[model samples]
Target chain A: MAFEINGKTYETDEEGYLANLSDWNTDVAGRMATEDDCDLSENHWEVIKFLRDYYEEYQIAPAVRVLTKAIGKRLGKDKGNSKYLYELFPYGPAKQACKYAGLPKPTGCV
Target chain B: MKQIDWSSLVINESGKAVKKFMYVNRHAPHGTIYPLEGLEVVLIGAAFDQDVSMAFIGDGVFQLNKGQDTADSGMKNVALTYGALGDYEVTKLYVEQESLDERGLELNDLMNLTWEDEEENWAEKPSIQVVSRAQLSDLLEQQDVILNF
Candidate 1:
């Protein structure tokens, strides 16, 4: 699948994960959020930025549990809970947020 | 490790090409569903008659440590599932020696797993093998696919 932003088409897998990591941009993320039927809120951007930073360092998208703990440690207890995360990304924090972050799908049981 | 000529052994007994699959366990059993789910996948793969193996490295070795009692933890004792792998015909289990030594554990500290060899009139056979890091690396290189957990 492909999406257009500023006249440049960005490719993605069938599940909507970015086909090319280098193709990620703010516009692409906005488009993805729109496709997920979600409006990009400040809270959503916060999680997305955190996920991109984490993927940049670890080269892997963390599972939901690990992501929650890390977010709790870095952000705050209020923003760290799965309830709040799910409020932002109704599908799944790790799967959906990581897609917007243009990272690979997390492996393993998650 | 014996190096068999791949060209000479193209098809398996079922006339289908065999694929060597290595499942890498890098996390402990509990606190995460990796090892549990990894074992489930291995069982499913084995049912398809694939050449399946598991490598316990780093914290993954903790999954096989003996004297585990999950009663107090309120979690099911999933480690016992390792023993059933033999029945699934998924017997190749490699434990990294360096990982065990670093953690101050020996082979005796792990669960004694055995498999029934039907060809040998139901004789019991050990399923686990402790190998050096270099040996494990060689084994990893030979796998057609490696599923890291």
Candidate 2:
């Protein structure tokens, strides 16, 4: 789906993903952040970017264990710890981030 | 603290044997060990001195499908476990319809087992109540001693 926000045309998927774009407007970003239940911050983007890469590669959303390992490798061991991971996405990282990324809930999420 | 009892491994709680159990299976077999572990428990539920009801939902439904043919998966191929269920007195098998569709599976995929009592089969499991997502929560709310696989 394409939208003209503040006269800037942008594209997203049916689930509201920014198509081939990195930057986003404050309001839309905020909305996405709220939907994902994460406070808007640089840290959240790290997880979000990781999720995008995961979905791109596996074509399936990862559960938290997979997410944490991937994050630990890319970011650092501190970020990948289960307690820290849950602190970032209280409802659960893989679940909340997938929602914010405008993707369907991952398989085996339950 | 109430001790958790695996269905297959459990014969008596404290001292008395229990009957009329509800067994819930919650995983797919391949990626996780939960499925095989769940089946072992289900077999116990069947061996219990009382009646047992089996509920297959989410990826757990994979356990009941017939002709699974997975001997090469380097596991016990626990798919055969469902066939032996009836032999052990586990006659009632209830599957959530929504979960079937979500996984693009159907009743036809299951073993040619008898439907549970017609009352539950009318709606939901009609045997035990095939729960939709919300219905699952409600059903869980009603259980007294539930064993999840």
Candidate 3:
């Protein structure tokens, strides 16, 4: 699949995940969110940034439970629960958020 | 346009293409990665907007037993992950009744899972259902794809 932003076409896999990880940017995330009918908020960006950083450090998207615990440690308890993360990314924190963060889809039972 | 097998397309009431995917979990949790890995596949499958369901049979029913704490074991307590299935649009969790009976378990022994119904102003709905072994077998026949773990 492909989507256009500012007349530039970005390729995505069949599931809309970025075909090339390097092609990702805030604008790309914004476009993807728009297509999903979701408006990116500050809270969403926090999770996206956290996911990107987590992937950079560990080379993988943390599972939802792990993500919740880690975010709780870094951001605080209020934003760390699975419910809060789900509210931010209704699809999923590990899958949807990671996709927007420009990382490969997490493997194993995430 | 290229030829398309229009009849092969199955769309749900909401107008999204959907396939009936059933994830079978038959292994005990914490011992093997099947249950956890199976749930992962269920979540990812749900993201594709498919009609997804899960069945807990055999020793898998033990995965849902209540009051499970792994703090001492130093393992990531994944039992709570089952509660999040509804949030991922995977609300059809069928627990085999015979499996529970044989293991001396009850519905109340498992976590109470609920999902938000966006169409109903986000009203909460129950996600887990205890089905008889025969009923579960019928359900298995209806699935377009079955992922066994």
Interface RMSD of each: 13.3, 14.1, 7.8
Sorted by TM-score (best first), the order is 3, 1, 2
- Estimate every model's Cα lDDT from 0 to 1: 0.82, 0.62, 0.81
Fraction of native Cα contacts kept in each candidate? 0.00, 0.00, 0.04
What lDDT tens digits, residue by residue, belong to model 1 across residues A1-110? 88888789988898889998878988888988887788998999999999888766434566676677668867988988899999898888988898988987753323
DockQ values per model? 0.01, 0.01, 0.07
Off by over 4 Å in 2: A1-110, B1-20, B114-139
> For candidate 3, what is the DockQ?
0.07
Backbone clash tally (model 2): 9
TM-score of each: 0.55, 0.41, 0.59
**Candidate 1 positional error at B42, Å:** 0.6
Superposition error at A105 for model 1 (Å) = 28
CAPRI-style quality class for the chain A–B interface of candidate 1: incorrect
> In model 1, what is the error at residue A87, expressed in angstroms?
52
TM-score of chain B of 1: 0.92
- Please provide, for model 3 over A1-110, each residue's C-alpha lDDT reduced to its tens digit, 9 standing for 90 to 100: 89888898889888888987778899999988887999999999999999887665434566666577668767988998999999888998878998898877774433
Docking class of 3: incorrect
> Model 3 chain A — which ten-residue stretch has the worst lDDT?
A54-63
The full ranking of all candidates by lDDT, starting with the best, is: 1, 3, 2
Q: Model 3, range B1-149, lDDT digits (tens) per residue?
A: 89987886888767987888898889988999887778767766654767788889999899888888887998767786676565566788899999999999999988778776757966789888999988999999988899899
